[model samples]
Target: MRRPPQELWETDVLTFRKMRNLLPKYVFKSLENTIKQRTKLDVSLAPIIATAMKDWAISKGASFYAHIFYPLTNITAEKHDGFLSVESDGSAITEFTGKALVQGEPDASSFANGGIRSTFEARGYTAWDVTSPAYVLETDNGVTLYIPTVFISWTGEALDKKMPLLRSNAAMSKAATRLLKLLGHSEVATVNSSCGAEQEYFLVDEHLAQMRPDILQTGRTLFGRPAAKGQQFDDHYFGAIPERVQILTQDIEERMYRLGILLKTRHNEVAPGQFEIAPFHEEANVASDHQQMIMTILKSTAKKHGFMCLLHEKPFSGINGSGKHVNWSVSNATQGNLLDPGDNPHQNLQFLLFCGAVIRGVHKYGRLLRAVVATAGNDHRLGANEAPPAIISVYLGKQLEDVFNQIKQGEVTSSAPAGVMSWDVPTLPEFPKDPGDRNRTSPFAFTGNRFEFRAVGSNQSVSGPLVALNTILTDSLTWVADKLEADLAKGIELDTAVYAVLRQIMDLHGNVIFGGDGYSEEWQTIAVKERGLLNLTTTADALPILKEQDIQELFETTGVLTASELKSRFHAYAEQYIEVIKMEADLVISMAKTMISPAASRHLSEVSATIMNLKQIGIELEQENAERVASLTNQMMDTVKNLGNALNEHNFTTIEEHMQYCAKTLRPMMDQVRKYADDIEGEVAHDLWPLPKYQEMLFIK
Candidate 1:
């Protein structure tokens, strides 16, 4: 007997709720305390904390612990080990050591390193990141420890994502301290960059997802005919969340909250089955760690609800792709925010100078900024209507732009414009704010106190982009500090010196500031021809910019990343691009051969048999039916042959060679193969089609 849907779903929800309620509040409390205290690393504390974490996890039925780290591939890595340790008496104990808690050894040969390590040299080290708290993960068997760590090769080369991120954080802090001191803020000791990433993703039924090999392997649908309904109406944006999706969102949020991640918002996105989740901003390092953990938790929790979370940039055709909008800002130990414009910001010299520093940074390293968000998956999304284009520019709404323009013109301004807000109810509240509207099409938009980098891909690690942003800002601030100090030494008034610097920067780099449509062709022409901004359209084009002499000097001087490390990253990205394309190609061939071909062949045979039976009864087969079967069969056969041949021809060895092949040859062929298969699918009977139809997967609850 078929089980009742409500009963089964309700049971799952109840169990998940129980798990959510059982999570210890003290875990997050302890984490909060740690962040505030800046406690020294006490080696003795590891075992005790590990024991408590293990106990909590085991109580929830987790069996093993995994040291989770982020590697160079822009994805999380883990090496699981059981908690059992055998004593001399042949008894097993759940043992965890402080040494084990501090470090781990894993084979690094399989990971991409851009020639940092050879295949034979397999050793790599994972050191626990003391700043990020340890967490417990509960599974079907028992609980396990999840320690955030940084991976490095035996020769001391950084092999993972965390090292560069940590280095960038330190660099930003140092640069910010210097700037603060120069601005007469001696009380401020430390400054840190903060980030709140708004993650967008799609959810589709697991059964339907499993039926499609492209999604199963690649986390995206490599081929699908566009549905009659897409995001054209924009009805899904902020729309009411569906019941099943809401349940999944609630479950994921509860898990993240338990893990000390502050998930703040969840809502429908522009595309159907697509949603976005945002959290309150935290220090960049912590924010990146939390973002990584959130993606994992979301996928796992969604599976418990019989859905698959799609993190691919362009999961389906003709709809908005997912992006991780990185909201970035800076704060000091004493002051609240460096980016906030006070009530009378036009008169605030410090605020204007800081703003000028950012504008200068964006203008100076715009290509590097584009390079940060470059990835194989992201190429399809950027420059499209659904996302901000590859052209790097800053959007400082009308009010701020006008303020800066006035400064550049050497005009004395009295008061800046105030932003407006309406509460709708007459008696409730009303407020005036900035005199500008937001531009969703802008790649980098200043929203209130922070800059939202909208070009980041959903599947990418936030660290890379944050690292570039922080490093560039650090360089820019350092330059501004030098100029300010020189002016002050020459006996210039602070306000006058600040205005002079702002004017100089505005006059030189003001072309990067655009408060208009970034998607228009006219803007592209202006950005390139008049403004002289770079448009790096692909990972291949963008990665090389990192090797520029100026970029290398910037990183080396800031101590954010060594030139060697930067080269490794460039190589890693190039190799990863090729591997991703190859993986997709392999999946396409597998699906075409096993699922598409067989289904189409069976349908063709059945149609032929029906025609024969009708002909035996002295009635000729319908011409339309006969023609449809023949055409579809021939197309399917040709597609299969072409795709198979393309796969066989992938003989490139180096990463560069492979990338060129994929971009110039492989991807286009795959598209051609998909076209015929989709046409055949549309012609075949519904039940005979191999994969789930777009309508069913997208619209079904």
Candidate 2:
């Protein structure tokens, strides 16, 4: 049967409504109540829920179920279990109990735990996160029920990213709801932070991508020379989408929509063969899950179209890298967008207070914010002039900046108005968007009703950043609530109390707010030296901030993570950094010695023999080309030896020192090798080159 086009837009797979219709009325209502209240479903209710889930999966042709979890590695992990079971009579039967529906054991020691789990402590549990609906994933391997779960150690420690996010969300909700009541709003319930992540990525032909080892192993090209034509002309941004890419986009959207992802827009990006996808905002928890799904589906779907999707922050060296701009805001049913200025921003005391809370949060915990986005891939993008600077700063538009300045001085009399722009021709319609301009250079910018966290890497999970934002906002809102309570006790008017509380917040934290070019050196100096913001330029420098005393207290106070959990995260991230660099360094050395050298030597011999023939014929040519090739090859080989030597050194006093070596000593040595290798690439014949060139990989699709 032909389905209506609108039917394709509706969420069908594993959605709450689908289950609600599949199950008995009372049973589904009980399940809905449990999800809404964040409570455990009764054991009796679970059997009914489990049966309904199993029947739904069977209807979708799923013979197995997989428990999916997001671990510390910024990727999803799944363990599939078949439904077949043996009864006492030895007949085949499918059994799913409430207990089975709720829990499963996956090996924890195999995953990166930073010494948290030893070989003997291999037990880990995946408990159903009832809020994130389970969907039946379809693949050639066969249909399987995919359940979103929180991975945890048997001893009750959080062993995955989702746990912290859930905790942080709970903390933020409590604090926000308390503040709302203090401000005379009594009907507030379950306040949530929302996220709309703008995902940017590059699409390269799979055939070209496979030829590049770095692209295959590390999600980026490690040794490719610069493309002749980069994003220099500024023509690709918002340009027409390619036909092949458009097909891939439609396939991805179709799959994503069925899973309930609210995809909203698609377009070409600033760099050639690069594109972006954005979705309408949703609750942070669900939005992050959807973000991960989007990335997975993007790559898997592209492969079907013969394209390799590159999600690395900087896939190629000389062009604009990608970023996942996480648009964030907070609100509840009783309130609509706490950050919304609603025409007269200055007069909206509630908006000012909430916005002030964000300013304060960013200023006080900007280092934590920076730490969340730190990664080996992101190091090549952040503060590289095209992306936001490593230094964290908030960009409120000129009008909002002025309004805050007025509030700082004591009174806010008028707001910066968003005026209409009328075209000279009568046919064009008037536009009514706010006149406040957005600053792309700023790491965090307030756009309309939300803050876009532009510094987050393109390939990272949104959970870490969202957790930090929520926990910090919890702290800031707690501060506001305390001060407002004291002020109201003194018989001050609500508006007067809000202004005073916000004024104090602005006075203490307004240094983090800047509406200028964040990439400028002047801003860098002013930010670090004058304004007191930390510039953590590398993952090695930033990841350690996760264990800082202030950060420890921040997480502890909000119940987001314990001190031990934070330390474990620090160790895990450091371990990842070290492991990634070591692998890349090893790959670089192997490729240089084997692939690059052989290619270079072949070209050099061919050139030298041709020179000898020319000399015999009584004609002389410049031997500079031959000498340069030999010199570059020898220099690259020498650098490769140095990198190997550095990798062998294991005398680091601590993990931090080891990471510093990787970032400073090892990474630089690898780069030195790359410089010479890239030179050799230019000197060698393109037909003899073993790896794909950056231009071909970047522009061929």
Candidate 3:
């Protein structure tokens, strides 16, 4: 039986409405101030709020609570504790104090702290993030109260994604508020960045997933030949959802709704067995937290429905990959969305200024944007035909580009209106169309009201990219505000001063805007040589941008991260890249040797036996198939040996050099080995093949 919308939606979440109803009016106001205004938390109200939260959670059938935090590994971490407190008289009573709710001590030795704290010094703190609401996570066995928190070291260094995100948001808000004031909005509200990440993923039957060692160990397949009828036919995009998958989606959406996540769209993505779910925009911090839970629920619910959710950017070869397109924007209660270009964009000075700020930010800190989304899994998706290219360029549609161009040329001109679309048929009514079409190939595209960052990988936490975007925008907005104030101080009129600043910005940073195909080879060449933009083709090329002095200064100047904290992130991400490649290299060797090579050898032996048997019967058989298998097996083993040797050659002097070796040297060697192994897969008998084929896994469901 299905439940009503009002009955099911947000029933498990302790949202602001729930809190307002549960707590006293005064306590609720104080907490709301803390959440909305970023003010200091009133300690006096914590006890009352804690008591209310406990009672509410208890009513929801929660016996335990967990302080959930996101560590550097781009995943959620939680340490659960019971509400039962033992007394000296052997009696147990449920007790949750304000202090316990506000603070938690979780051993951080095992988390990826990026050398922030030594293993011996295991002290870390989880401070409650009042901005993101707490909710009850229901599992098969029981339900637990999950409160999102920020993890930090004892020395006050930021050790988790949420801390930097919150700090970056603060920095952006301060700058945005200043800019809004400069635009003559004296009563500006607190500005915040918002995000709606469109998550793309694949699903394979759990039974088949368990049969493949590569899929079991890594989220992606190490080697598999392309399916004969893969997504090449272009039939799967927005195709009919399979019945089993539909049930899974319904279950996942119901769970998401209860957790207060507003999932807006679901459809078949370009690739077979691939799908995407997009949520409505929310505060960036809460959106990131919800994204992690969405991934968790997708996997858990898929498993219950006999499927394995694959979140890897490229889980299979020769098919479209997955990306988490982060649709980002900035807004406030006072002015509404800052990026919205209303009907007449020529007169929308506020929108133009804000849009110019983003342009300046992307132009100045494009490499930093690239570096944040760089990961081993994403390396396969970026620069491919299905995903955006490695170059970080903005795509403003024809209408907005025209307005910006007019501003650049030192004039105010008429803006293009959205035209109507109609067919000749009388029955087909006409509708208004957008001024310009969408460009899916663009890495950062301005779509309707927000910019969609299309390069983010499916498996990554949205915090890293959000932090980078907020920090860079903060820097850019601060620059814009300073310029405006300076021009105004010189007795320039407001409109003239704004146009002067925008003209200067366009002249300097306009090359980052492109409304063309980013995946084309011509654009790749022109973007670098003609436009002077970077084409960071690999993670090794991209991650080095994080360590640049300008990037370090950007973080330092904005108060988003200290010098040590930024350096630690560079180290941690570089180490992760190296480790991922190393792990994949090891898997390639193991699977090729233990699974692929043995199967090929057995088939070769059988073929040779058949040849001998036919010869005895005076009917000769050609050994072309057997010879091809034998040759491919030898080539694969030899390449695997070379890959092993390269992996063992860890005599590099710097982490940068090690990363380059992994990218330039070892990755190609692994691909070389895979080529041979995949060729063998084609030649081997289907019944004797050790691993599941791509055809079955992709099309079975």
lDDT against the true structure, each candidate: 0.81, 0.89, 0.93
| Model 2, TM vs. native | 0.98
List TM-score per model, in order: 0.88, 0.98, 0.99
Best-fitting candidate, measured by TM-score? 3
For each candidate, how many residue pairs have backbone atoms clashing (under 3 Å)?
12, 0, 0
Candidate 2's C-alpha runs over 4 A off are 1-5, 10-12
- Lowest-scoring 10 consecutive residues by lDDT in candidate 2? 2-11
Q: Can you rank all candidates by TM-score, best first?
A: 3, 2, 1
Better of 1 and 3 by lDDT: 3
* Sliding window of 10 residues with minimal summed lDDT for model 1: 10-19
Report the number of the highest-lDDT candidate: 3
Off by over 4 Å in 1: 1-65, 81-97, 412-416, 419-429, 432-434, 601-654
lDDT of 2 by residue, 1-701 (tens): 53443676544467777877888898888888777766676667777788888888887888898889999999999998888889899999887778788898999988877777787889999988888888877898678888889999988899999999999989999998898888788688788899999999999999888887888998887787887888888888898888899889988888877778878899999988899999899988888888889999999999999999999998887788999999999987779789998888888878888899999999999999999999998999999867999999999998899999998999789986788988899999999857589898999999999999999999999999999999999999999999999999999999999999888988899999999988788998999999999999999999999988999999999999998899999999999989999999999999999899999999999889999999999999888988999999999998899899999999989999999999999999999998999999999988889998877776644
Tens digit of per-residue lDDT, candidate 1, span 1-701: 53433333322111223323543565434533444444445555556555655665566456677788998877788999887889999998887676787789999999988889899999999988767756666667656667789999998888887888888777877777787777788787567789999999999999999988888888888767778888889888999999999888877866766666777789999988899999889888889988998888888898999999999999987888999999999887687788987776688777787788889999999899888888878988998888998999999887788889998899858655674788768896877756567999999999988999999999999999999889888888888889888999999998888888888999899999999889899999999999999988887778778779999998899987888888888888887887787788778777877887777778878888898998999988775855775676677567667767766775767666666777777777777777877777776777988788778787647
Native-referenced Cα lDDT, model 2: 0.89
